[model samples]
Target: MERQRFDSHQEHPPAWISGYHLVYIQEGEGIMRVDGDPLLLKSGKVVLLKPDCCIEMEVRSGKPLFLYDFSFTYTMISDKPRQAEKVALSTGHHMLSAKAAVQLSLLLEQLEQRQGIEEPLAQWKQSILFQECMHLVLSDPVSSEETGGTREAIEKVLLYLQEHYRGDISLKEVAHMHGISASNFSGVFKKHVGLNPLDYVTQLRIAQAQRKLKASQPIELVAREVGFKDPLYFSRIFKRTVGVTPSIYRKHRHTDKIITLLPHLNDYLLALEVKPFATLPYGGNDHINGYLPYLARELQETKLTGSWNKPDMDELVEAQPGLILGSNWFPINLETVKKIAPTIPIILRDDWQSLLLDFARFFGKGDEWKLWMRRYEQKVMQAKSLLSLSHSSRESVMILTVTCSEYRVYGGRRQLGKVLYEDLQLTPPAGITTKAHYVCVNLEQIQAMNPDHIFLTTNNSNPSKEQIKNLKETKAWSSLRAVQKNQVYEVESWLNGHAPIKHSLSIDVAIDHLAANRQKPWEAIGM
Candidate 1:
């Protein structure tokens, strides 16, 4: 047994195993890819690796990994009288209980101490400790569940296929690993995972290809990224699966039948003048069929596809959408959704301007974004001119979001904060010093800053109504200069969404309240 400590974010070179190996994670967490299948490495978790397996280990960033590694050959006593035969153990991972892990560590320590001791008594003691360690491994309930049943084995194979599908995977080699014929394994895997091994691989590859295409990546490069060698063949397969040519799909010119799994993504589709075929509700209640009041007019004809968390799959199927846009936060299963239509998981950033540009470029609406930005800049200039008369640039503005339970103060980086501090070029309260997104504060902290203006809003409507009412009754709230001057503007709570439509609407609302101007030319164009 060797104690191995790997540095943070370190990736070990790929090594082929000559004997059976077991790794007991002593501290930290990471991933170990065995024959191209990833296994999560965490504290108290043990992994068994079989002979001839290729393995690579990677530690997560800022987290150093420590493991107790044991490698040996195995000989089992057979049921036959006085017979011993070599046997191979299965490859899988199991979580060890805290008590069992501690006992195993003690046994390993004793065995390590006995290493290199050539005396007969020392060798005998080492053998006993090794046997005790093996007993602890074999007796583990989770380990037995991982390696004992055919169903469990098939599940592991499914996960392996899901991770390595982009690589060149062979049905014969996969079947051989399970000690079965290719035909038999295919039938069993199809029964369990709902698709044959090869078909499942194709589905995974094509799903990834659709995401790359949406990002405006080159067809040739996208092909190579998803395991396709020939760009022409990739295009043909893409057309066959997606019902449009690759170029047309990338340009987003073929269909308007798009489904947005998240509500704010609807704002992006609308800004591009592409009405979504279906969308999820905006607020918490799934049964309410709620849409953001600002976006309701544009989405009136669009179908409501239930909640984002648990979308009605039948509604999605009936829509016959050519594409589905979603984010990582959506709880719907990606594989199941991909079966209905091509789904792209969006990576969201805090900057709404960049997100708008990304969406515009994705849908071949760069000219539209440029046109919209011109109108937006015109509106910003007008609003800034009006603000210059009523307020100075050095005066502080605070965006305080009240929920039922807490208060969150936004700095210059947040959506609403960008409109006030960045777009309008106003100042943030002295209390908000960090570069983090938003900071949770108490009433005492709010009283200390005493900004010139305060934009008060709830995270969502109804829940914080009483909270806001009670807050206004406080002495600290009544003593503020902004409160005395009637500068506490209660704006729409839905301004929390980070989207182009939200940004435009926020500016309109801010100008309306702060400068007493109701002009909404920027919002008019999108509507």
Candidate 2:
């Protein structure tokens, strides 16, 4: 056996004796002519050749091919004839014997040692050793179980399904591809792969759908992209597999305010639909800027408004608002606001979703509010389902909010953390809170938690390279799995603070960065 490493710029072999040859692609992808058939070879892939078998190579442009090539001849041992046979097969392609690699390595070492030696005895010994190696190589049994016919068939189906998942691929077509009847193929496939053909395809479709959803594509577009003609049908299937609608899934993935309002619309409406004269006094601070003014304007445009903005206490005796929309941030005196508009209803829009719902209710076109509300509900439910699944799956994460002086480790109260754990279905660290924007924690707490990923958010102040390096080098931080795996992600505070539509996109970026190294398919889906 003889071996040599070939570079991208190396000259082709001269027209000469082509005996048993084996090539291992270490890096780069290319096309190789094996036995006169063009075979695609990717990195970490290998090929084998027989005597007089024509072989050629074509590397992808800009990607120089790196390969290990071995050529050898075999002689009969103990009067037994040598024969070539397939060893391993994957997706219709066969692989050479595993020992081929070992033999090739040793042969390469021998050739290197005799680089300039042309002595007849040394050459004879090399030839004999090469023959002996080839004899041992060819004599090894091709494990029928390793690349069995059934495995080949299954791989073929998997590849085909992956390639045509967005098209109309039927069971009959798959079965016919392998020259088997649908019924027989179904039985064999199920017995061997543990899933019926259709179920397998659906699973693949769901995986693709999850990816598309995480990418923030609209549910309808995701349905169409995944080959589902009916968005409702797609929703049903997605809910069945993921236990949430796609819209909800996308919404829940982010810690936006909309997720909160989705589940509490009735409460919101109940608070908003009060009689003006019977309303309580709004006691919030007048200095605060709430959505009240905007709501009042919208109500007036819709023919349902009155002196609702900056109303005086005496106004309670005369004209009153039909409704009062307020939130936790409402600065007006809640008592005074309600009392001045006694007949008006006061609705609290504290959560992000509630604000959207409130806006839709007052400003949306006729019946459009209802549609929007329903969509919001779907989004929330989907998020809840994902959170439940993530919990069940035992996937863990860490949420960190970056600030100017130090980073704040949200301990379960931050809306973003809640959304990650309770909506998107990720198992956030138990200490993280969602009650406020973010909280501060030292490196000691992080080391103890040993989270799989760290979700970090930064304000206008970006951490300098030195700051990041110092943080990573801290004694308490060095022990953290996330840090060890380089999973520390810097997020923008605006994403975690503002309720703008762009918040959803920010959440996606955070998930992708935090879950960059996660191994599970769902984590990858979130990414």
Which candidate achieves the best lDDT against the true structure? 1
Candidate 2: segments with Cα more than 4 A from true spot = 1-350, 365-393, 411-414, 433-437, 462-470, 498-503, 510-527
The pairs that clash in candidate 1 are none
TM-score of each: 0.52, 0.31
In model 1, where do residues sit more than 4 Å from their true spots?
1-253, 284-289, 516-527
lDDT of 2 by residue, 29-102 (tens): 45666555556664434555656655667664233666666664443334234555433321123444434544
Of candidate 1, the 10-residue stretch with the lowest lDDT total is 518-527
Candidate 1 residue 180 Cα shift, in angstroms, is 68
Clashes of each: 0, 52
Q: lDDT score, residue 319, model 1?
A: 83
Best by TM-score: 1
